[model samples]
Target: MAHNALPRPSSLPGIEDLRRGYTPSTHEARQSIEERSKQLRLEQERIDAELDRHIAEMQRLSLRRRDVVRELDLNHALLAPVHRLFPELLSEVFIHAVQDPFNVQKTDFAVRVLCGVCTTWRAAARATPLLWTFIDLSYITSLEDPLLRLQLQLSGQLPLTVTAKVQDQAMQLLLVAFFDGMSDEDASRVVEITVEDDGVVLSQLRSRHLATLRVADVNIWDTCTQGELGFLTSAPTLHKLTIGVQYECEDDDAALAFPVPVIPDLPCLTHLILAIENEFPVSAFLPAISQLAPVLRVLKMSSFEVSAWEETKPTVTCEMHVLHSLELQHYTHRFLTFITAPALHAVTLIGDDAQLGKEDPTESLLDLLTRSRPPLRSFALHDPMQGSASALSGCIDLMEGLQRLNIEDNERGVTSSPRLAAVLQRLVCDENTPPMLPELRSLSVQCRGDKSPCVHSDVAAPLSQVRLSRKDPRVCAGRAVAALE
Candidate 1:
């Protein structure tokens, strides 16, 4: 390689006369200089011609080398073990390349790429129905009929997962492609469905054996008035349901425009999450959720108003015996007063003072605790009432199994500043207190900055006493709230 890179000895001529600055002083010297210059020019031209010929030869060889290398690669690929595998085995490899069918997006379409690779791969991909089972129609909102038709045809008899974003303006196209495209048998094969859009309805949900349905960031307008959403009432196999609605319209009009909801018994549902952006009546969901109480293990509701549920009240107060976790935000205590959960252990209440104080909410919550008598283990209250000391004491008295307690941003009145201090002081000092919340393990309190300074010293005094007399409580305090004490 090194020898080939260097210029040939005859190709380079040394300019010794020029370097020595040999001036032509006489006629003979001038003729000798001209003859030498001419010889050098002739040699240079010959070298240039030789270089051009070598470059042309190198180009020809390089093309031949590339062709040989390509042929070798092709032969090696043909001999690979993967090529010998059965078409079914190759189809499995294609499925693995896709990773997860449910979460696939239009941009990273693995099935389509696999089909376009070669004739054999295309045949394998086309023959495998599972590879095309999950169809993401989110990007093709204009209802590109060919793609939908291809997906449906390829999916065959396998269970399908469908995801789409049906915009309000594109409802007709979505309906024509998704709703009208499928026969009852084809729709029944659908196992999961997700829709993210504004004021759009999917009537086919009623006919399908869907197990998971998530309709996120929706604006339910006049479209649901056709009773298309009644599928949620009788979806016997549906296990997980998540619905998020943006409420920016008149409440009564929106309620009336919505299809009259009919929530029947759901025996298989384990997870239910309902989130409304604005204040829709929490009572509106009672008809549906009451039926779910028997089987639900986790229930979360966020951002809703509370009003009377229906004119014909339920005669029996449904008990949620299986419900273990409950999370609520921007909700009133009226909901607690309505239902009872005996097996409830974890509870999180996130709200402001007004919502807690609405309709004398503390008493309602206390009554709920008294009635349900849950083996309460974990409790959290966000921005609770000013008089939380008494409420905390009462809760501890009722729930002897309580282990974790979390409170946040308690800054309402003069008494509120020392609420934590007072609760601890009574628990440690009072002879008759009997070690309130004896099993307490973790206590977290976050107070307003202005109040913590004055309250810190008061709370600190009981730290040593509580530790000496009883087991140490894991105390976490912030915004100047005293630790341990």
Candidate 2:
């Protein structure tokens, strides 16, 4: 392209006189100077006009260049490898890219990002029903919000896992609408539900195939009546139930008023977890387990008030014939006296070390083992309040079939080193007696208290002997000794 050359002023009328600093003393000379100044002003305006035109032209060309680059980039993107991928494969990629679709707080952003990528990706995302199956209405601001409806619609007939935090009246209304909008078939496709209740009576989950239900409440005073939870009784396929409640009891007498939520008999219920916060009398809830799901395989309980059972012994004993695993926290060995699990294989107990005066759980554990004679393989005891060496050794003597044993003394009290050493010594086999745990494959002893030299020296010999006897010895000692293989 040919460009026009900018014009320059040839010369000033009195250029030589002005350079020489000649004064315009006469009227004619001053008049002549004024005329030249006027001409110069006219020329300057013409030059500025020309510059403006060229500047405008350059800007126009720059915009055109940008448009051309964008077009080329779009064309190149169309030929990319990802564009060649089948929609089905791309949908799977989208599914993996989005982590925890049920967590609306995070997955909602991911879904939006995937949809905003391109028309093809948006179509693939909408077509993938699995991505939309988790309909979280926890933060739904308005009933008119289309995201919730879109999720349900795109999910189609696939099984849904719904989660909602019913914090206010608006959220409760949305939750109701969420269920009301669903067709009978769509409702039946709901397999799992997690609801955090805040004194709201939730719409009964009407799914016949409902397998898991997790309900948590920060306030225990707002009780869910049996009538409110009547839907659980009809949910025959429900296998897992988790109820977490935070109770604020003012006094010991308040525990007497503790209301036990109606837990309906779920015949197929296999796993049950009750996480109760704050101090509530164990008697208020423990006895009810006898009538819980008969075929329950796992029972985990936490944060229960450990009552002095010596003063008031529990007459009622819970018999769980098919229970395979049991875990309890903030409890004494006395609590074990109230339960019997014959099929139990794993037991984890986290004792309240603050209550150092409590009786050792060794006898209670021995009693339970003798009573049930379960094929116990794994046992983990953490911070036992009054764990004695003799008591622990006696408990080990009963568990000849134990495969994994983990004992942790976090307090490192006066008895911590001797207790750990005694347990290790009990594991050693001699000429007179048979091995304590012949099937033992893993032993983990952790003492967080002061490390006594005698502990390492005493347990080292026993640990070496035990390792020599076993084909695969995996012993991990924390702060006391190094791991042995």
Candidate 3:
């Protein structure tokens, strides 16, 4: 009964048996790992340095590539036709780029965009006075904005068309300052101006420089202490003037007479339009119109408040000799009796719902026409009330010179088609009472309620007969009916 035993291992072994027999204690293996980790970290550091060198080289090459592209672009630009164009040609192009100088809301985009292109372009655009002449001060953010001064200086001796809208008190003061600071020479350069503000801006520009003024949407009577509208009387050169005022008073007692002292004689004022939105005493505004009658070529008054006025016998008859066009809207018959236009060629009368059945202006209108004996050619009556149609028909009876007649009854809430039809049917050639407006060639009829062809047929039949009896085929253009309805 004998047993066999195995041999014990040694701490170290020869290279031949090392791979199979060698094994380290726990501490010895940890120490060996530490040494290997340190060597690997050092090797990683070396590799990182090489990577840094490559990255730096790539960055340097990228900068050099950009420089080369920039130079190529510059060379290409030099050869371009636009770059070779003379400054004069560039100035002409800049002038052509400006769009809609009359639009008060638009900014000066043309000059700004052209000047921003390059230093050379900026000099060329700035030197062109025509480009800066249409300076819109509406978009100016502050008084300190250099745009106003720059534009004024760049414009040099050329005339300017200035348009601005003031939204606040600060802007109004700024506008006043802009005009107040303008030298006499610079102020004289302002030929045309359109301002929409609270009347202060215009009062500052009372220098005798402005020629044409269109003051729109101005709040006057309520804002001004004296309710003065004589803002333009100082402009001796003013030829064309348009004034629109809004009365924001809550009650009639709050209403004040506009232009308290009354508008002075504008000796040179030829074209005048005064549009009042709310009710004002005719006595207050009529004097202004009467004063301008002598020199006025065209007169238009629109949107007056309806009120009864005491009629006093006028000592002197105001006559307008050069007046070619007269248009009155929302006014009473008594108001028309004030002034007479002898040379009137065109008359447009419009009455609203408020003017319905208030007063008969036809007698005065007929009397005025008889007295003036104007060569009235065009007449338009829009939205006339009930009794107004028959009374105005008398106008046709008196006016044998009328060439064009337009009758529109849609907005007045009343229809006078039947009465108008009767008047048209009565048009006949007779020795005692000749056909009304024998020279009438064009007739325009418009009705909103019943625009059916049958409604206008009664009037159309006689118009065709008149044209036929006269043996004038050229009386109308395309159709026997002047308008569809």
Candidate 4:
């Protein structure tokens, strides 16, 4: 072969370069293998470093995620079981769990969260049309039309729930919207409607399944005007009716008159609470009660009026049946004039002495107990007016099945700053007229403030807290008496 033009058969281009000047020997080959091994090691080290950094970053991210979770505000959640999942039931539970009225945003968020849980839950949540039932008309500037629109919208979906706070004009319009939204076909879909205001406009809301209706802060002055109200023909499904009547009238008789009360026959009614004041006319309710309510099991009647005489007859006559609990708050002399409940099982009387008249409130209370259906199982007498006493014998005569008796403001006339220690010894403390209460199981006496302001300032001022007797041997059977000095 010519010098540069010819190449040896064993000398290939790439193979000859690998071999270089020396022949392919074991040691040389070993060196090449070692170099390749070193390169691989370097690459592995770089990869290891990158992996360590990546791991550190992942750990940091995890820590940040945990921190975020800790800072999150948690709402009350009923940890339901995963097995039997019912989204609508969960939503109902959440509705009641939301005790904070202003947390409507949270409520909406909860509904969304539940819907996002699973497909089955989402379907269930959607199925319950009443799930989104809430009325918040706190801002009453453009109330009537806006509220009416909202009411109509809610009426279209499922049953409606009315919850809002508005004053005079807005309240009237809200009432109108409520009545107007109902269809004549059936009222069963309307679940619950609650109103918290002192004013009310009589509207005919005859629902089929409307279970509960409550109205708070009822003012006598806000009743139906001469031509404003006639008759409420549709509110027959109301199971509970709570009315707060603020007394501003000097004449009790005229104040209590209802413009027109044409109540429908309602047998499902069970509970009635009326806080009438300033001479609210109970007679006006007669037209409604005579035809409307029949089965009342719990009746709570109170009046802020001192001369609310018109309600006495009805308060007594209307309340004489199947009552299990009775709470008489601020019992004016007008109620004591001729009040009676033959079926009352539990009686609670709460008021200051100033609200009472010359008659001993205890005697009047005992008189009712005698007329009650059976022995009052629970009796609470709170803070009677000054010089409070009922011939202990006479008061005990009222109860036939007395199980609990709670007496508050037991301090008599000792705050007059007189040295009647002898009288206190003979007629008060030492004069234990033997326990006449046979079946009395629980007795609690709250010796807090006195009826007279003088006594309260001087004597009752020191008593801030009193303890209840628990460890007594007769906890269940013995007459429980709580005495505070």
Candidate 5:
């Protein structure tokens, strides 16, 4: 063959020429390619459809977010007009909102929100009585004139039991407002009036409506307490009165300054607790108290007043039908003569030191318990053994119905306490915690002795005396019995 010559191509085919010249090899191969092309085209159409669906879902979520924002705007929008139209509604809103005490704890947001609505809201807030129902002068420094009007309205028909505690300011205005609400008619409804203020502001005025009065922790450190008690006599219905007085600038000869409010003849007093700070001339009061508190069930005293007279003969002329529980702490001899609670159920004596006093009072106290109205169930006397177990042992049968009993002396140990325990051993559980008490289900004993087992071993049949500590000889005996069986 001669040397072959080839023609040189001028350029590559254009996109249009390539498209036109494209061909399939066979019918089957052409069908396979056409099917693949149709699949690719359909796949691209499906991708576009999915994109459109995702865009619709995104639009829906955005519209929902806008709706929530709009609702929030509407809800917050209603409050402003409500406060303006009905100004009293501001205080009412506070009354309803303050139902949750936590709302008023740190910041009274609900209160301020209502008050800040407008000037009319503020005026209505000042006038509304319910808003000032509980006067927490704990935070108030300045007084608005309407405070008195609000207090009177809030008191309504009920007599006042005003319990106020103020330290910083002269709470005289607050007291005036409170007392103004009480008419002579409101005296019967008053249950108690307790005021704890500094600087002896109580000396400024007197009240007549109170039935029960307790004034404690007044910061007149040098103020005499005895005369101050007289100030409480103004209350006509007052039966239970407590005064905590301080004696300052003590001139032994100087007479004490106090209010002399005439204490009414209290015929209905059932309980009285008197705490005199310094040496008070209560000898004058002894006859009066006895005559007045005729039906008195409980009488409590402190160490200072009644220490003088060893035997204060308290006449039990009135019927003590409802006297059951008696508690005496730091009592002196004069207080003891009045200890005739004929109907006493339980007696707890704390801080009675005969060692310091002139007389040994163990016998008199025991006599009081034995002569009580009913059988005593639980008797607790501090350092009881310091007196005599024999005296206390006499009080066991005071109450046949008394099932629960607790006797504990932190000072006494195994040797000293066992005497009392022996007397109370009737309550002990020998077999399955003495089932004698069908009414008494549970019993506990905390007093322990060193030589004695921290807990006594359970009684097993006659053979096994000690089953708890394995070292007990009863274990060997039990094993022997088993072998024989």
Candidate 6:
């Protein structure tokens, strides 16, 4: 199409006279001004029309560009490798993407996100029963809420790991109803139960198929009767049991005087963890340990204290023939003197300076190792107050078959530099004297406290000597030094 030229107002005959301020005194001059003005208005209108056409064309091209981009993106997504994966493989990917399915705070978040992605993903997520097996009752607001029932239905007949945080009487009643409403098959499918409740809920709930049970904040005085804890004895398949007791009484002595609930003999039990908030009398649980020693493979005791009266009493040693791993936290040397593990391979002792009392922990440990003489492979000591350089050296000298050693010194004013330096120096091989822990494959030493400039210098030489002499490709060294502010 041919276009008309736009009028140049400056080229108009009378326009220059108007710019020079020439007054139109005559009728012809005034008429000429009016004619010029009329022409200029017509040119402005044409320019505005041309701009509107350009804007419309730009809008149309922008819409076309948007459409093309959308098509390109869609085609790229269709050609992606993940889209070609089968539904089963896609579901597996979704499963791995979900982190900590049993966590109450993030319960069902991953599954809900997967279901919202697309129709195909929603179908795959719904078809995978393992994705819905974690039943966290803490998120359920009411018994009438269909979320719980939906999870149960979606999980199908798979083994469910249930976590319940029943804090009030209403939640307790709800928990009771939840168990009572379950079918026999559903009840049998619950293999693991972690409940943060008082003893009442656990007393009533029983499952023969239960393999693991963790009860937190259990009030020993509430469930004093044997009948209340009879459910524990009924689960023949139970292998792991963790009990955490927290006493809120003002008189800790009085609380300690109360009788501890006698744990029924668990024939199949292999792992037992007891965490007490206050310093509990060891006498209360000593007999129970003696009873469970034969079948127990892993035993962990925390915050245990031997009463002054009990300290005067004779130490009754309990022999554990099959126990392999033992961890003690905030414990005294007297407690270690009472047990002997012949098959122990791993020993982890975590305590502060106050827990060491007057007794040397190294001596007690040496006694245990000498008495039992098990093939100890791994040993970890965390901030023992009495762990002097000489004392630690004496203990490490006995572990000839040790493979892994971890020492963490977090004592406030005490640094593990001296102890670690001495231990590493002993490990260095000499022509005359053989190296201690010749089979050691892993060494981790962490020292946290006010340290001197020479702390690292003191430990570095010995550490380098041991590392180079050991020359084993599998030897791994982890050294951490932190200054306390």
Compute each candidate's TM-score over C-alphas. Answer: 0.58, 0.71, 0.67, 0.55, 0.49, 0.70
lDDT of 3 by residue, 19-77 (tens): 67866558978698688879989999999999999999999999999999999998887
Candidate 1 achieves a global lDDT of 0.63
State the displacement of the C-alpha of residue 232, model 5, in Å, after optimal TM-score superposition.
5.6
Q: RMSD for all candidates, in order, please.
A: 11.4, 11.5, 16.8, 19.1, 19.3, 10.8
lDDT of 2: 0.66
Instruction: Report the C-alpha lDDT of model 4 over 55-119, residue by residue, as the tens digit.
Output: 99999999999887755622212243642545556556645544457766433443556466667
Per-residue lDDT tens digits for candidate 5, residues 1-485, read 23475654566434455668866668997798788889989999999999999999999999999999989977776564664556555667666765575654312332466456557766766565455444344434434544434554654654344455655455656654545544555544455655554334555435464544322222233443333333355544444555443442334443432211223455555566655455443342465455544566665555452333223244553334456655555544334445455556666555443433333334556555455445555455543345454655555433344445444333323344554454445433243232222222223333334544232222112112111221222222222111111
Which regions of candidate 4 are displaced past 4 Å?
1-131, 137-159, 168-171, 182-187, 196-200, 203-221, 225-232, 246-263, 281-294, 308-319, 332-340, 353-359, 370-373, 385-388, 410-435, 449-485
- Candidate 5 regions exceeding 4 Å error are 1-132, 136-151, 154-159, 166-169, 172-191, 197-204, 210-263, 276-288, 300-322, 332-334, 352-364, 370-385, 397-402, 411-420, 426-485
Least accurate 10 contiguous residues by lDDT in model 4: 421-430
Order of quality (lDDT): 6, 2, 3, 1, 4, 5
Clashes by residue pair, model 6: none
Q: C-alpha displacement of 95 in model 6, angstroms?
A: 1.6
Decide which is better by TM-score, 2 or 3: 2
Clashing pairs in 2: 412-449
Residue-wise lDDT of candidate 1 within 210-269, one digit each (tens)?
333322222343334334344555356777677665535455765563233444455687
Per-residue C-alpha lDDT of model 6 across residues 8-55, encoded as one tens digit per residue: 565867568779997879999789879888999999999999999999
- Candidates 3 and 6 compared by TM-score, better number: 6
Which portions of model 1 show Cα errors greater than 4 Å?
1-134, 141-146, 149-159, 183-189, 196-206, 209-228, 232-234, 247-260, 304-318, 353-363, 384-387, 410-417, 424-433, 441-485
- Global lDDT of model 6: 0.68
Scored against the true structure, residue 111 in model 6 reaches a CA lDDT of 56
Q: What TM-score does candidate 1 get on C-alpha atoms? A: 0.58
Candidates by TM-score, descending order:
2, 6, 3, 1, 4, 5
